[model samples]
Target chain A: MNDTSTAKTGLQSEAGAAMKQNRTAEGTVGEVYVDDPRMTCRNVDVYYGEKQAIFDVSLDVGKNQVISMIGPSGCGKSTFLRCLNRMNDTIDICRVTGQIKMDGQDIYDGGLDVVPLRASVGMVFQKPNPFPKSIYDNIAYGPRIHGLCDDKQHLDSIVEKSLQRAGLWEEVKDRLDQPGTGLSGGQQQRLCIARAIAVSPEVILMDEPCSALDPIATAKIEELIDELRENFTIAIVTHSMQQAARVSQRTAYFHLGKLIEVGETDQIFTSPRHKLTEDYITGRFG
Target chain B: MNNQQQHQKTMERVQQGLDRRYRKERHFRWLGLGAIILGLLFVSFLFITIISNGYTAFQQTYVKLDVFYDPEMIAPIGETDPEVLSRANYGGLIKASMRQMFPEVTNRREKKVLYGLISTGASYELRNAVMSNPALIGSKAEVWVVADDDVDMLIKGHIDLRLPESDRRIKDNQLGWIHLLQEQDRIEKRFNTTFFTAGDSREPELSGIKGAIAGSFFTLLICLTIAFPVGVAAAVYLEEFAPKNRWTDLIEVNINNLAAVPSIVFGLLGLAVFINFFGLPRSVPLVGGLVLALMTLPTIIIASRAALKSVPPSIREAALGIGASPMQTITHHVLPLALPGMLTGTIIGMAQALGETAPLLMIGMVAFIVDVPGSVMDPSAVLPVQIYLWADSPERAFVERTSAAIMVLLAFLISMNLLAVWLRKKFERRW
Candidate 1:
C-alpha cells in the first residue's frame, strides 16, 4: 500500500476548493459556516434491560461521506448503527440515552415521529430480508408509503433507477414481477439495497450487508458501496478490516462498547495509535 | 515376540466387541419402527369400526297406509263443534281403524297389540285433516304416515314374531295381519324422505332432525358474527400495541387458562347470566350461540396471537420506517399475513362447538322442538343434543337414528377440518 499522507492533504485542499465553489453558486459569501455535523452523537449509551451494551461513545458523521464502523465480535458496532436510525426502539429491552442529531436537529426528540425519521435514514439488515412480494412491490413499498411516486409510470421509473444504482438492474429488469425471494442471496441483498434507495433517503445504514455473501458477491457490494457515496451518506458496520480500509474514508474502531479509536482509515491501519487498535490490526488480540 | 502377539490378540477382541454392539443397535431400530406401525394400525381399526357400524343407520324403512275416517265418530251427530273434535281421543281412533281392518280380532288384549302397529302421530294426522276441512269430516280419506317402531322393525327384518307371544312386542296374529297387508300391497317400504324434511318430535317414529339442523346453522351464524372481529381485535391489541409489563403478562396467562377451561363451565355461566340474569328465553339459538362464542373466544385469540408473532419483526420495522403508523403497519402488513391462520382457527373452533353437547344440554338446547327455528331467538335443538336425546330414548329404532346422526356430525367436522388445512396450505407464506 502507498503511504499517502501527503496525498491526503492534497485531497483535503481539493475538497475545500469544491465547497468554496458550492457556496459562490448561490451568491452566498459563507455567511453561515457549515460547522454543524450532519449527525452528531454525544455520550450515547445502549442497554438491553439491565445489561449495558454500548458505553459512552460520541461521533460525528459528515454529510455525503462514507463512515465505516469496524470491530471484533461483541464490540457493539451493530448496536451503534441501530442507534443512528432509532431501529433499537423495536427491541423491547433496548434502551438508548444521550443526544443524536441530524442537520443540527435532535433526532430522538419526544415530539418527533420515528416513522419519518426512519424514512429519512433507511436501514439494510445483516441478512438479506426480502418481503414475500414481487420484486417491484418490494422496491415500491417504501416509496409508496412516503408518497414519492406520482403515478404508475413514475413509480416504475423510480424502481428502475434504484435497481440500476444498486447495480442489479440488468439481471432483474425482465423479472421484476417475480417474487423477491426467488433471487440468489447476492441478488436479494442488492434488491434490499435497491429497496432502501427507492425512498431517496439522505443517509443509508448497512449492518454487515455482505456478511452472508460469498467473496464474489462481497466484492460486488463493495464496488456498489463506493458508487453509492456520491449520492447519500453511508454508514457501514463490518467485521472485515480489509473492507473497512477499502471502502471507508474514516473508520471507527469499537471494543467492548467503547470507541477505542476514530481517524482516517489509512492512518488507523498503518500508524501506531491506541494500543487496542494496534493490537487488533496486527492480529495479536481483537 | 510375545508382546507383539498379545497386542494383535487385544485388537481382534476390540473389533469383535464393536461388531456385537452394532448388531444390537440395528435390532433395536427395527423394533422401534415395528412399534410405530402397530400403533398406527390400532388407530385405523378404531376408525373403521365406527364407520362400519354407523353406515347402516342412514337408510330407514317406511309403510304406506290408507286410513278411512268414520263421519259419525268424528263429526258427532251434526254438532259441528271444533273443540269437541280436537279433544276427541285419537288413540281410540287408531284402535278402531286397526279393528276395522282386521275384523277377526275378538280379544281386547290382541286388539291393543294390533293398535301398536301404527304410530300415535297417525291419529293426530287424521284429526288435523278433519279439522282443516269440516266438509271432509263425514268423508273417508287415506293418509300416508309413519308406522310404529315395532311395525317398522318387522318390515326391516329387525323383529321375528315366531319366537313366542310373551317374548315379543308384536304377536303372531299381528305379524300374520301385517303379512296379509304386505301381500295385498298396502304395506310398502318407500324412500325415507321425511327423515330429512320433517322436524323433531316426541314420537320416535315421526321424529326428524330438520329443526336441529336449522338451530345449528343459526347458532354458528351468530358465533361467527360475534367472535371473529372481537377476537382478532383483542389479539392485535395484546400482541402489537401493549407494552411488556406484568399487567399484560397476567392477561396473557388468563387467556391461555381460559382456553383450557372446560366448555361446560361456559354453559353454566351462560345459564346463570344470559338466561336467569339477562332474561333471554331458555333454549333459544341466540343464547346457545353466545355461550359457544364465549367458549371459542380464547381459542381464536391464542391462535391469532401466534400468527401475529410468526410474522417477522423486519416487516413491521420496514413499514414503520417508511412513515407508516402503528395501525397502518398492522392493517396493511400484519393482518393480511395472519388472515389464513385466523380463519383456520375460527373454523376449527366452530367445528368443536358443532360437536359440543354437554354445554348445550345445560342451556336447555336438548328440548324437543317439533318446528324448525325461524329466527335467532326462536327455541331450537342442535344436532349433538338431538343425538343425545335420541341415544337416551328407550325405543330400539332411535338407536340406529342416533348412529346416523353421529355420522352426519362426523362428516361436517371432517369437511371443516379439511377446509382449514387447505386454507393453511394455500395462504401461509414463508419469508
Candidate 2:
C-alpha cells in the first residue's frame, strides 16, 4: 500500500501522452440551460482531502425528463450525481463547493435542514440496501419517517403504488413480510427504487442503479425509468452508452472530472462535437 | 512406452501427496478434540470436589430435649417483673436438663463435656420461648435445640471416627451418648434454615450466607446500572461521532490499559476516593459497587466499540441516503443491529464484577455483617469477601461452608453466561 504513490509516479512519467489527454474540459458544453429546469447546478467543484475529483461544471436537469450521465470510471459522474441529494456529506473527508439549487432555493444554505431536502430528492445506491427489514417495511419507511400518510391504510396504498410503479409488486406481493435481503439481486434493486419513491419524491437520483443486474433486469428497470419520467425528474449514472440512449432524453458525458458534452442523446451519439468525445464514443480509449 | 511409464509414476506421486494431507487433517482434528476434553475434565473435577465438600452444610443435626422451667430457679424475683425475667439464667436451665439425661457421668470435667453437646446459641432458644409466653415459666415442654459444631461435624461423618480419644474432639463417652440418642430417635437431621436466614457468626452452626448474597446482589445491580449505559455511550461517541484525533486515540489507549490493571488497585482507589474523600460509609455495597463499576468500565467499553464496528458501513449509508439524520440513523438502525453484541459484552463484564474480591477486600467489605442488607448503602459482606473471611477461620466446619458459598457463586455466574448466550441467539439478525 505504501508503494502506490511511487507506482503512480512511475506510470505517469512513462505514459505522458495518456496523462495529457486526461485533462479538464474548458467548460460545460452543449445546451447547459433548459426551459423550466427542476434543478440548476453551476460551477461545482468536489474534493477528497488534498485531491480534487470534480472541476467547475454546470448543468441543468429539466422537470419530468430522464437525464442519464454516462462516463468511464473516476470521471466524477457518480460524485456529481451524489451532490444532487447532498449524499457526499456522509463522507468525512469529502468536501463539495458548488451552487446546487433545487426549485430556486440554495440547498447548501446553512439554515436549510438537509433532512427535508433529502426527502424531496431521494437516492438509490449502486448496491441494493433494504434496511434489514421486511419488503413491506422497506417500501413504507420513507413515507412513515416523513409523516406523509394519515393512517395505516394510506401508508399501505402508498407502498403498493410505489411497488407497482417499480414493477416489483407481483413478484413480492405474496410475501411482503419476508426480509428484503431474501429477494433476488434484480428484485432487491427495484425495491430500493420503490423505497425512494414511497415518499413521493419530486426527483429521484439513481447511482449506477442497474450496474449489477443482468441484461433482462436492466431492460426492465430502463422501462421503469422511462415511465417514471412522466411524474418525477430522474438522474442516473451508467457505464453503458446504449442504456443512456435507450432511456434518457438528455445525455451528459463526463471526462476527467469535467462535463465534456451534454445534449439530446441522439445528437451526442450520432454526431459528437469534441475529438475526445468522438474517440470515447468510438471505443478508441476510455 | 516410456511416456506411459512416466505418466503412471506422476499419478502415484499425486496419490501419496493426497494421503499425507488426509493424515495431517485427521491429526489436527484429534488435537482439537483432546484440548476440549482436557478443559471439560478440569471443570468437572472442580464441581465434584466442591459439591462433595459443601452439600452437607445445607442440613444440620438437632437434639430433642424436654426441659422443666422451674419458676423459683428461673425467676427468683417473680415472673411478674419483666426486667427480672429477662435476666434469668436460661443457659443453667438447659445444662441442668442435659445433666438429668446423662446421670451416670460423675466427673466434673465429663459433666462439662456433657453440657457442651448442645450449641452455645441454643440457650437463646429457651430464652425466646420463655420470654414470649411468661405463663410457660413453670411448664414442661419439648423443644428441638441446635447441636454444637463438633457434634454436627461428627454426625455428617466429616470427623475421623477412629482417631485416638486424646486427638478427637469427642471422647468415647460422648460418642456412646450420640449413638444412644440416635437409637432412641432423639437425634434428628433437620433442614438448616439457619444457613440461609442468619448472617455471619463465630459459631459455624449459626452462620449463614443470606447477608453476603444480598450484598452481592446490590453491588451487581449498582455495577450494571452505572457501567452499561456509560460504557456504551462512551463507545458510541468514540466510534461514531468523535473526530479521529490525538486526544481520542489517547483515551482509547488508556481504556485498554485500564482493563489490565490489578483489581486490588481499584479497591485502593475506592478507599482513597469514596471513603476518605467522598465520606461514604465503609463496607457498604454502594461504595464497593462504584469501585467494581470503575474496574469493569474498560472491559464494557472495549466490547461495545467492537460490537458497533462489526455492523457494516452500508447500513449507515442506507439510512442517511433515505433522509434520516445521523442521530436517528444510529438509534433506529445501527444500534438495534449492534444490541446483541453489546449485551453479550455487558454480561461478560457483569460476570467479572460478580466474582471480584480483592477490590472489595481493600475497600473494607471483609467486615462481619450479621444482617441482610436493606438498601444499597447498608454495610454488608459480599460473597467473595465472605468466602475469603471464612477460608481464613481455623474451623473444620467453616471449610465446608466456604465450598458451599463458592458453589452458589458459580451457579450465579454460569446462569449469567447462559442468559447472554440465549439473548444473543434470540435477537441476532442475519444482516
Candidate 3:
C-alpha cells in the first residue's frame, strides 16, 4: 500500500510537469479574433479523481455555426461537451479546471448565475426527455421559469411557434394537452427540441441526440438541426461519422483526451490532414 | 428399413404416453390455484363475519317515556336554584319510568333491576333537560333516552330470555316488559347518531368513539404540519446537496436502520423525549402526533428519496446544461416531476402513522378520555387505542363495539389507500 501510494504521487507529479511543459510550448497557435467567441475553452482539463479525462483542451466556438465534435467511445468528446455548459458539475468526483467563457464573459465567474446561463445555452440530451407533462407544458417550462410569457395567449403563441420551428406543430397542434411522452420516439425528440427552443437560447448543445433514435427519427432530427443552425450556434457531439459529415460546418476530432485535428468538415473529409484524423475517418482503429 | 421405422414410431408413441408430464403440471397448477383461492376466501370470510356481527352496534334501542316529576321531589316551592337543579336526583326519574313500565314488579330489588334496563346516561339527559326548563319539573313530559345494551341486544334478537336469570343481566320478566314496550311502539331501534356525535364513556351502553376520531384528526394535522416540510427538506439535502462521503453514508445507513426499527421503539423514544424530557402532557394528541411524526420520518425520507431518484439524470443535465444552478434544477425540474410520487408517499406514511398505536400507547394515548379533544394539547385517545381498549374489556358487549371500531378504522385506511391509488393514477408521469 505504501509503495502504491508513493508511486501514484510520483506519477501525478510527472504528469503535472508534462502538462506545464505542453502549455508553455503551445504558446497560442490559434488566432485571437477581435469579435467575441460564442464559447472559449482554455487549458481545460477534467479529471475523475487522478484519472485525467481531458488534457489542456482549448477551442473557440464561433457564433451562428454548427461545430461537431466527433470521436470514438471513451475519447473524451462527451466530457468536453459537458464542460461547455458545466454539466459535469453534477458528478461528485469529476473536476474541471481552466477558463471557459461565453460571449467574452467568464461563465465560471463567482457572480455568474447558472439559471440564466442554462436558459441562454439550451441542450437536447442523447435520449428524448419529454417531461411527463403535456406537450404545451414541456415547451412552456423554460419560458415559464424565465418569465418570458406575458400571459396565457403569449405562452400559447410561444409553444406553437417553438413546435413549428421543431417541425411538429402540424402533427400535435390539436393535442397540445396530450402528454409529450405519448408521442413516437421521433415526435418525442422533436418535442424536446421545441422545449429547448421555447427558451430562445443563443446556443444549443446536443449530445448524441440521435443515438437512441431509429434511422427515420435520426434523419428528422438532422433536418431539424440544419434548420435550427440558421438562428442559433449549435454544438453537437456524435459518434456517427456520417452524421458529423452531414450536419456540421466544422468538425473537431478528439482521441484519448487530445484534439487530433479541427478544420472545415468538407476539407477534413476530402483532403489530407493529420494521420490520426485520416485513420479515424477511413474506418481505421478508433 | 420399413420394419425399423415402424418400431421407432411405436417407441415414440410409448414415450409420449408414459411421460405423465401434462397430468403432473395440471395437478400442480390446480393445487396452487386452489390454495390461493382458499386463502382469499378465508380472509373474505373473516371480514364478512366481523362486519355482519358488528353492523348492529351502529343502531341502538331507545325508550320514549313520559315521567311526571312531583314538585316535592324536584323543584319544591318554585325555588329555582341552579345548584338544586344540578344536584337534582335523576334516580327518581328512572324509578318512576320503571314503575310505569313494569307495574307488576313490586319488589324494590326487582324494580331496580328492571330500571337497569334503562341506560345510565338517561339520568344525565334528564338532569340536562330539567336544568334547561325548571318550570316543566312538575308536569309530565315525554323524553327519548337510550335503552341499555342488554335491552338493545334483546330487541335485535341477539339475546334469549330462556337463559337463567343469574346468567343474564336482564331477567325474563324484564324481557317481557321490553317486548311489551316494543309492541306498543314505545321502544324502537334507531340510528345511533350519538356513536358519531358523543365522546367515549365508561358505560358500555353509552360509549361512543367521537373523542378518539377527533384525537386522530388533530394528531394527523400536527403530523402533516411538521413532517411534510421537514421530511422533504431532509430528503433534498441527503439526495441533492450532501456529498457522498463517509458521513453521508453513515446517515444513509442510519436512516435505513431507523426505518426497520420496531415501531414500539419509537414509542419508547417518544415517552422519554416528549413526555419525560420536554414535559409535554401525557396522552395529548400533540405529543402522540410528534412521536408518530418522528416514527414516520424515516418512511417519508426513504420514499421521497426513491421519488427523487426516479427523476432521470438527463433532466438535471438538461437544466444544468442551460446554465441553471444546482438549486434551480432541483426546485424547478426535479421537484415538480417528483411531487406526485412524494404526495403518494406522504399519504402512505400518514396512513401508516394513522394505524400506529404502540408509539401512541407509550405516550399514554390509550387513556380513557370521555370528552372530545378541543385542542392538540388536550389529553386524548386515538381510534386504534380505543379499539384495543374495548377489545381487552371483560364485557361481552364491548366485543361487538370493538369490532365496530375496527370496521371504522378499516374503512378509514381503505379510503386513504384508495386516495393514494387515485393520486398515483392521476399524476403518474410515464417517463
TM-score of each: 0.83, 0.87, 0.85
What digit string (tens of lDDT, one per residue) describes model 1 on residues B1-431? 99999999999999989988999999999999999999999977866765665554455544455455565566554545789878766656567666777889888888777777788777787777777766665455555666887787777676665777888877777779888878867676666665677788766667787888899999988888888889999999999989989999999999999999999999999999999999999999899999999999999999899889888887787666555778878988899889999999999989988888778888999888899899999999999999988889987777767777777788889999999999999997877
DockQ of 1: 0.43
Model 2 stretches astray by more than 4 angstroms: A1-32, A134-140, A149-164, A167-188, A211-220, A239-245, A255-261, A267-286, B1-27, B67-97, B124-142
Instruction: List model 3 lDDT by residue over B104-145, tens digit each.
Output: 889978877788888888888888888888887788888888
Model 3 Cα shift for residue B295 (angstroms)? 0.7
Candidate 1 lDDT, A144-256, residue by residue in tens: 87788999999999999999999999999999999998999999999999999899988899999999999999999999999999988999999888999999987887876
Superposition error at B28 for model 2 (Å): 3.8
Q: State the DockQ of every prediction.
A: 0.43, 0.61, 0.48
lDDT of candidate 3 over A103-203, digit per residue (tens):
88898888986677778888888898877778888888788878999999999999999999999999998999998889998899889888888989998
**Top candidate when judged by TM-score against the true structure:** 2
**Candidate 1 stretches greater than 4 Å from native:** A1-36, B1-49, B64-145, B160-163, B181-191
Which stretches in model 3 have alpha-carbon errors above 4 Å? A1-37, A103-113, A134-137, A147-179, A182-184, A197-200, A214-217, A272-276, A284-286, B1-35, B69-87, B127-144, B157-163, B182-185
Candidate 3 TM-score for chain A: 0.88
Give the local distance difference test score of model 1: 0.81
Best-performing candidate as measured by DockQ: 2
- Lowest summed lDDT over 10 consecutive residues: which window, candidate 2 chain A? A16-25
